[model samples]
Target: MSDPSLVLHRIPETLVEALMMSLRKSKVEELQLRTSVLKPKSKVVVPSMRKLLTTEQSNKASKSVGRKLPVPSNQIRDIVQHHCSNKLTKGAVEAIEVSFEKFFKYLCRDVMAICLHAGKKIVTQADIELVMKRQRFIKDNKSLQILIEQNFPLEYRQLFIPVASSVTLKQRKKN
Candidate 1:
């Protein structure tokens, strides 16, 4: 964090500079989290942005803090404070919220699609894991993955599935 007092240049004097400054302020983040597990490779969407946004269920997400979004900003801020940085800025929190929302949306979409295609009304962790295999996950450490997977309490998971695979698969006969 740069000290406000170590002054080098003056504030935005022109309109263009002012707009740029405003954008920069809105995008301040200590860490750059991946927005979506399945992000578009191209910056410009071939299909209109409006159509993509509307079709992707982005409207289901809320931007305001304290709202019941898919991934709450407060929870993300807490996670960042606990694991990554203690002195993160508000902009960083907003960024996390945005990324989490996208990631969660993609996750739900993929999981639901898989379940529906399989003629199942209920979605299971197996569906989620299958989708994850096809999606692009963030660059988190293996230790972090292990920690999260095994961080469950004894009561939540009492002598059940093995660490290797949680879901039980049925065997299919091949002619």
Candidate 2:
């Protein structure tokens, strides 16, 4: 068993530099730590930037640090910090919240359409292009009368049909 106080000697400088850079980077802020070691020339205690480790770094550093690697980021951990003093403001949050419902609905509809057309229920980065293309096609071809409503079904066109129908209604009823 390795002693907690006895850190491994003769650690590689690149690994140390990488460790320092990774742990000190904005992405891994919470795990930041400070350690001091004497430089051979300076003979003074200098703070070591190589104090913490990323999951990858920690895994490699584990062989030397003699402990389990740190956990990687997940949805919960990735939530952007809501520091009041930061540039982000309540107005921005409110704006996002206001559109959140519409955003999710559009996202779900797009994903479902892609799945229905492609026969793949699982969404991937590749599906993003198809979704964007479909949206652009609908937006660009608004003035063009529905030539083949058969290909694009009613359920998906419910939002667009009203606008198109209003422009050229066969029976002129009321002002």
Candidate 3:
């Protein structure tokens, strides 16, 4: 009791091996059964990642989302594989697709709210930008505009971009 010694109370070899296997599978900081159970300094997220990672997408309560996404699955696969050294697991790819779908749904939902607020039935890029501006901690409307201009595919950039215009100043001479 004074020493907190449990060496006399030995664990079965199989249990010890299984615990080590689970720890290794989790890919956290190296732990050994030297004294007592050691906890990692920071959490290893494979332990916390929800197994119910969505494979499909859901729409907002107001509108039905399109089943087909603009970005092809192959493109997602390619991107994931490129980052993962030419390897993509089926679960990981599907999770990525679902995450994108969910992100898109929320983005559209906010944009739709803006349209509804303005008493307009059409959702526009302007509405999307407005929502982003309103949602951001600090107003940086042009930042998002610039991001779209830079990252959007060249073919589509001209169609819906909000070109940020520079304000000009004139000096008046006073007597």
Candidate 4:
């Protein structure tokens, strides 16, 4: 079979100049030839490429995702909308919601218990403090105090010093 003559054609000077300038600007000597080569070299994404996702590709991808179920009626989607605004895998969003729901349940239970015990309609910061005081888990212990300080919120930064000092004072021999 006669090898097809490799045609060496001169691209129009204007086009070649444009391509050379673009190559220089892009800091690459040559671009690989494909649909990408035909794209107008620019910082912006190629508009044509953006539109190249064929209906078949779209259909196959959409089909695999399964249809979104109708939004639930009870919960205002607005509350969760921020959490869901960004693109996330289905499982990731489910896990995050599950985690937040668990945390919220624990927080509400603690608040409710304090409110019930106090016989007060309005739960305040003092109620939270009182609960913290009564709690046997890691409230006054120095090692646990340091662990809580490192891990938990720094709302009461001064509380750590007092807690550590109180532990030392209790251990000291009084005159």
Enumerate clash totals for all models, in the order shown. Answer: 0, 0, 0, 0
**lDDT tens readout by residue for model 3, 49-146:** 32222334322321344346667888657545544665677767767888888878887888887788899987775777677777772265457656
Q: Ten residues in a row with the worst lDDT in model 2?
A: 67-76
Model 1 residue 63 distance off true place after TM-score fit, in angstroms: 6.4
| Residue 160, model 4, lDDT | 41
Q: Which candidate is the best by lDDT?
A: 3
- What C-alpha lDDT does candidate 2 achieve relative to the native structure? 0.49
The superposed Cα distance between candidate 2 and the true structure at residue 138, in angstroms, equals 13
Pairs that clash in candidate 4 = none
Query: What are the Cα lDDT values of the candidates?
Result: 0.55, 0.49, 0.58, 0.53
lDDT of 2 by residue, 134-160 (tens): 666434554223522433344334443
Candidate 3 accuracy as lDDT: 0.58
Residue 134 CA error for candidate 3 (Å)?
3.3
Clash pairs, candidate 3, are none
How many clashes in candidate 3?
0
Runs in model 3 deviating more than 4 A are 1-67, 78-86, 137-142, 149-175
Tell me the spans in candidate 4 whose CA falls farther than 4 Å from its real position: 1-93, 130-138, 142-149, 152-175
Q: TM-score winner among the candidates?
A: 1
Clashing pairs in 1: none
TM per candidate comes to 0.42, 0.26, 0.40, 0.28
- The TM-score measured for candidate 2 stands at 0.26
